[model samples]
Target: MKLANVQQPIRLGAMTLPNRIIMGSMHVGLEKLPNGVERLADFYAERASGGAGLIVTGGAAVLPEGGMGEVYCNVFLDEHIEQLRIITEKVHQQKGKIALQLFHAGRYAYKEVTGLDPVAPSPLQAPINRTQPRELDEAGIERTIAAFASGAVRAQKAGFDAVEIMGSEGYLINQFLSPVTNQRQDEWGGDFGRRTRFGVEVAKRVREAVGRDFPVLFRMSGLDLIPDSTTIEETLQFARMLEEAGVDALNIGIGWHESKVPTISMMVPRGAYVWVAQQVKEAVHIPVIASNRINDIRHAEEILQAGRCDLVSLARPFLADPQIVAKSVQGRFDEVNTCIACNQACLDHIFDGKVASCLVNPMVGREVEWALAQATVRKKVAVVGAGPAGLEAARVLAERGHEVVLFEKQERIGGQLNYARQVPGKAEFNETLRYYQTQLVKLGVEVRLGTEASADELVREGFAEVVIATGVVPRRPEIAGQEMPHVVMYNEVFEHKVKVASKVVIVGAGGIACDLSHLLVHDEVISPEAAEYLLAYRILDAKALHKLQTGKRKVFMLRRGKHVGTGLGKTTRWATLAYLKQNGVEMLTEIEYKRIAEEGVYITRNGEEQVIPADTVIIAAGATPNDALYHALAGRIPVHLIGGAKEAGELDAKRAILEGAQVGRAI
Candidate 1:
């Protein structure tokens, strides 16, 4: 794999990249305290050991006003040099290259902390901030440029092998380059050429500050993913200018933070930004790095093999398994825990003010010192069902040096997860299945596909313990449309067996429901149809979609509750709401499902009856415990049920994995 070539040594300008894979910079507010630095040191050291060629530390503020935040970050002052050095030295010990992203949040920074006003090409604060920012004067602009140069020099002196300018994600440099944010009449705004000047100046100054041969990585947006901003063609021109300025590489980024279309900003597909990389690479002489929901090797390979980008940057995958490269090399990829992108684990944890961790790999931040397994002791374990829960359970147990067996009723693996993966742009979910399958094989967890491991068989076989992970069933909503031919459940739609009408209406507002609304009505970010399906959701400004429902589309999301539970992360939920509204999606909340007709759905909102127009009806109400198998064995034998079978996927994966581990620990 060209990207995987990072696992071995390669020349990266002045720095010899110990490998090809660069753990791209991700700011989780990790640059503040000694402990944060220590946590980061452990984080990088583990990846370095795991075979990362380079580790780019998260954004470090050049000036207090331009800082990403006040949390974890290395302040480029003389006082903090030693602390930053500690991180660089740790990576060096493993022959890894570590670069620090020199950043100035510019307008994104907090004015109170900077002692100076947050400055931008215009007097605009990011819409969310609602803060009235002071516009930058010519002198102030010069100072800001100097600040960036100083920050780059400080990073190089702090022992970083390279310095990457954080110009992507609608950051300062991007803010200057974008018409959406840079509404100034001066040379720094208006036309694309003028708007790009700040970024070009910043790059030139940064290179001069760091010296000609000292490898400087420029992070740039491939597409703003924002309305009324730079287009793909302009982005290509910027990439050329970036290279002409002596930039070593461009870490291509897409989208702006705090936008109505941020789903396109943060998610949609793994390596979704590869196209931006390709565009830039085609016009530039330097390397182009791509990222965006990228967590699978096969997808990464496609991007490289297709010559889309020079490198694939993985944030969550590396978080899930810093040792993913090493394990994959040994063909032990499945043994590496897979991230579900539930974002519940890492992103949610970060916003909630905790060090980042993977929902699948809880060991992400603790890699400097902790291990989940005990080498000397061992046990025999059985994991029933091969879905996310059961698969996670079996992998962890077997890795503890336990003798394990995983049973599945289907010829294929994955339980409910298989259905979930059938949705468009969700194929990456197969990564989890692949990881588990590989791990089970490598760990020698005897797999019994197309066979059910009945408790009776386990008992008769003299097995010490039995684990049951039967999963769940989707409950049909109790309504007049319950048996309607045009009505269908998300399960049926996802399974691809159910024939959807040319026009369809999806009910419910949880994760799956919203996902279906996005999918059935639009193309997934990864699909070729994405360009045509992109729809601007007026309800939730952040909820941008690509699917276009055949025929004139009308989806009625019926509700019967006081509050709609998004079941998405807080940020994503708000973003979704804003998007759905913006896209002209009909959401009838606090309404009861009364009936379904050929025309649409009949509903009652706040106790008042309302009839909504629809062509076909679908339900995302929820799931029921799929436990017929468990019920038969309950009285006959002791049976433990996990996952949806336990409580509709209600925070029970942890419970299931722990139960499997504890049961293994005891055995």
Candidate 2:
């Protein structure tokens, strides 16, 4: 657990980092804020002080047309340099090395935000962008290469220690490299040599502009994960070309933005794409950095020890806990809040037009606003729930110098989260529980498990204030014969309180119902060890391995609404639905539930009534607030209601934890 390999100092070009762990780039939407410059500076400064060996900033557009919406920073603009310089100065003050990523969105640029036509090597339209792009002409290509060089020069002026050319993830450089996006017969496309020219020329120009001794990293797509795209051999060859073009190191990026592959999802195993980086490292003399799902020091150390890559880059993990390195170095692994890759708060938020934040660590993007200052007066408080909200509130309150006690009626903590961890591919929820457990104990919060505190009991126990986070309960929908012998709730299914049938029908197509359907179908859960063993020995390919983890049974999910995954985040909804679809789970929408019968459930679809045959039926409609205790303690003592106890519209852990932290700061 010493993480000796991760702690080893490594050199990227002329820069010697303190350790091998690199904080990768993440576009947090902070650059577009009114006080963006100052806010961004504080955000990076915190991570720098938290002991990041080196930090690669969010992508900055090298040119105006290449901008990824208005949310991204344009380093090519001279007006932005002074603001960016503040960030570099603050990070330098923390004694941490920082790199600016020069980016061009190509066809990925948003016409709605930038009000300009996107330009790529070919006029092919991006699936996500949904707009036809103008193919870059000969003159435009030269201008782009020059823009990359100028971006690097501007980064140096901004005082960045290094520059990372964003060549991966379906960006401009990647668009030119892949045949899927580049079909032109010009000098920059149609063949492998032409496809690779743009990236190499950009790298050579950036190196020339920055001069020798200035660190330059190229983020190359190790695996496009898209069919008929760049082959693995071509990817490695491109890496060699980049090194020859004077890139100090190669940072391997897995999957394109258009790829359906689950690269950074919870289902993706830790270090899943390390082999791709290993291939690039073998092909190049320069150092290589592995990204995608490398979430912790242990996994990073393991990869480094195995000589897979020279260094590892973690983006979302840094957002989950800025002090991931510092805490691990101090041997406080449990204290490190691990990124669950839920995408609920971070990526999903950005997609929802909100700034990026973490689900577990709510204070990520709000470093300036939500500072955890010490309390002026210490008081004893009682948190009457051990779910995410209560756990976070208890941890923060104790950290703010309060004597806190966390109560739970159940034997264990993590209220609804306990059931969430039981769902297929959601095992990372257990890590969130582990972190809260560690933090609560570390901050001296007394936990009373298997005991529910009443109003009089809390008042009599000398508690100055009470936080009611009693959580939620499964809402039973009004359906005839729903209480039949074969009928059970979703929680019962998770707790194994009832036997599940093979041909099952699930009522309500919310997040829980989708999860239950996923659980029931995927009976053959492949362990990570078994998967790695199968792949390492070439016993099975990735496609074959995925088949083994899919449905072993039949499931049908019916909802009254037209949309499936109604409450799920945008980042994960499509993928989850796709998984269910692959498992042969039938998701029916715009249906009316009549009743549950012995044979099956009767439903009306398109004004036609029919019975869906099933041996078992489950109601995962939704949940309602469990606020009986909150009502009882309302006027008797000072009380604050939070989480499901306050509102059960959606079981949102992001809002729950944020509320907990806010209340913790308030008290």
Candidate with top TM-score is 2
lDDT to native, each model: 0.71, 0.90
lDDT of 1 by residue, 1-667 (tens): 3445444455556777654467877765444545877778878888888876677888888777777455547455666677788888888888777888888776777655456567677888787564666777788788878878888887878888999899988788998998888888887778888898899998999999889879899989887778878888888888899889988988987777766555432346555457667878889878888877776565665666677877777777788778777766676545666555666656776656565666566566666445665646565556778776677667767777777778888888877667656654456567667776777777788888999776667767654445677677787767775776777878777777687664666777777777676556553334444433332324222223223332235565666665454566755667655665655666767777777887888777777886776667787888888777677667665556766666774333434444444444433
Output the lDDT of residue 445, model 1.
89
Task: Report the C-alpha lDDT of model 2 over 1-667, residue by residue, as the tens digit.
Answer: 8789888998877889989999998989887788887888889999999889999999999988898665567787777788789999999999988999999999998888888999999888999987899988899999999999998999999999999999999999999999999998988888899999999999999999999999999999999989999999998888888888999999999888789988898888778899999998899898999998878798888899999999999999999999999999998898899999999999898877789889999898789788888899999999999999999999999999999999999999998898778887799999999999888878888999999898889988988999999988889989999878989988899888999987899998988888888888875677879999999999999999888877667899999988888878888888999989988989999999898999999999999999999888998898999999888988888899999888995568888998999999999
The Cα error of candidate 1 at residue 665, in Å, is 7.3
List per-candidate RMSD values in Å: 5.9, 1.9
Q: What's the TM-score of each model vs. the native?
A: 0.80, 0.97
lDDT of 1 at 74: 47
Model 2 Cα RMSD, 1 decimal: 1.9
